[model samples]
Target: MSHLLNRLTPRRGLLLIGLVSALALGGALVAQHFFGLRPCTLCHYQRIPHATLVVLGGLGGLLPLGLSTRRWLLAVGCLVALVGLGLAGWHVGVEQHWWAGTASCQAGGAQATSLADLRAQLAAGPAQPACDEITWSLFGLTMAGYNVLVFSALALLAGALAGGAPRPK
Candidate 1:
């Protein structure tokens, strides 16, 4: 495993990170569209960092960027991953009822003063899932829990790779 990790150049590492982000987004889409799992507002918030990382990693890996630029991108990716980790951890806490969720998580009441307002609210679409609800879990861990783990690993990998000293030519 160490040998494999050693072989991953900065370019390759960035590409790998982009690919992983893409895969994670794809999986979430599959779960939402095919499996019929609705995402809450917090879940939507958690995806933002992954989307940013996808662009950062892709640009750093695919473009003719300088070494310093690549390292900078990786450092940004690390920060994004840490932000994602925080979001996911917050979501897990919401799921476990350890704390209250955001206002958007409560979709129970949509007050409408008039018929037009009621129609507009109804036409807007179905209410999103509550953040506190655990839609799926494995080994007593929800998707947010898994996200915490994934983002933690990504943060560590990106930070380490970004800070690595360049080899003497």
Candidate 2:
């Protein structure tokens, strides 16, 4: 374990982080498409940070950027990861009914004050899944909960990497 940790320089760590982000995104997509798990508005929002991390980490790893530039990228990645953590935390709150989700998760159709309005609302499709509802869980932890853990660790790692660490060979 010590030998493996010693071998993980900043650049290499960034590459690994990027790969993890990509895998997480891929898994989310698979859960949505293959497993038929519909994502709520917040669920969709949670994917943005991972996507950003994928781009940042990939570029930082592949491009011949200077140390300062790489550090900047890692800093940006840290910020993105923090944002993801916040979103995931909020999602967990929503799932636990500690707070309400965005209006998109609620009934979509506008309130009908008249017959025409009612008809218009009826024409619209069914309401999307509420963000407060947990579609899946493992050991009482929702995907959002897992995201909180993952992004928290990622943010810390990115922050450390951004602190002028030596680049990997």
Candidate 3:
């Protein structure tokens, strides 16, 4: 196992990150489109970093590059993923009520004169996705929790790839 991983060049490692990011993003999109699970504003915010990282990581993988470029890609790439992880973690906390979610995501915000007015305001907010209500869950895990898990795993793998110590096959 270590031997096989040790043999993967940096380009391969970056490619893996890119592919994983895309897959995760795509899966979320599918959930939203087909499963009727709409993402809240925070969820969109968390997704942006992942999407950006995927594009950058893919370019880094395919670009013929020198050592400096490789290092920069890995370092910056990890940071991007880390940002996603942080956002997802926060969203998970919000879902769990560990902290207050934005008033927009759920009810209990400042009220408008009419339901129509409140809905319109919510539609126009910074986080159009709403921070309060979760769209879906599995084993009690919200989408944000899943993102935290996946992004953290990706960050760990990226760290190992950056370390570049030859591992056993």
Candidate 4:
């Protein structure tokens, strides 16, 4: 069983990871579109890197490849997952009111401007999803918290892939 799993084509590995990421992303989009659970700017910002990583994973599988390249690609995936972890941690902190979130959410930034600016800021749009709003939760964990747990598992998979790679002298 282990051998069969390990023998999967690199492209397939890429596809599996991409598919997982896309499913999670699509789920979030669905929640936002259908459920109207708006996301804060920071939450959105945190997603960008993971999106990039998913794309990279797909490309890595397609490019001319070998064990070393595959290892590196998986390493990149691990790093991106870690990046997600950090952003999730920050979101959790904001949710806990341990810290204020982005500038738009608060008014004490160095760039907080005049009365017009303040008025514009207020009127700019609906309150960006508050980091602490807790739009969705599962098993008593916020989305960010869930992300940390799930992505950590993926990172471990990446590390295992690296360890299983053919060693060089």
lDDT scores for all predictions? 0.86, 0.85, 0.77, 0.68
Q: Which of candidates 1 and 4 reaches a greater TM-score?
A: 1
Model 3 misplacement above 4 A: 1-4, 107-130, 166-169
Candidate 3 total steric clashes: 11
Using TM-score, give the best candidate's number: 1
lDDT-wise, the better of 1 and 4 is 1
lDDT of 1: 0.86
lDDT of 4 by residue, 27-140 (tens): 777878899888776668666755866786677666777767777787788777778777878878887889888766442333436888778766765556656677788888
Pairwise lDDT winner, candidates 3 and 4 = 3
Give model 1 RMSD, 1 decimal.
1.9
RMSD of 4: 4.2
> Across residues 98-163, which tens digit of lDDT does each residue of candidate 3 receive?
887665566444568999988887887633455757767889888888889888877876766767
Clashing pairs in 1: none
Tell me model 3's lDDT, rounded to 2 decimals. 0.77
Best by lDDT: 1
Residue 49 shift from truth in candidate 1, angstroms: 0.5
Q: Each prediction's Cα RMSD?
A: 1.9, 2.7, 3.9, 4.2
Cα lDDT, model 4, residue 120: 71
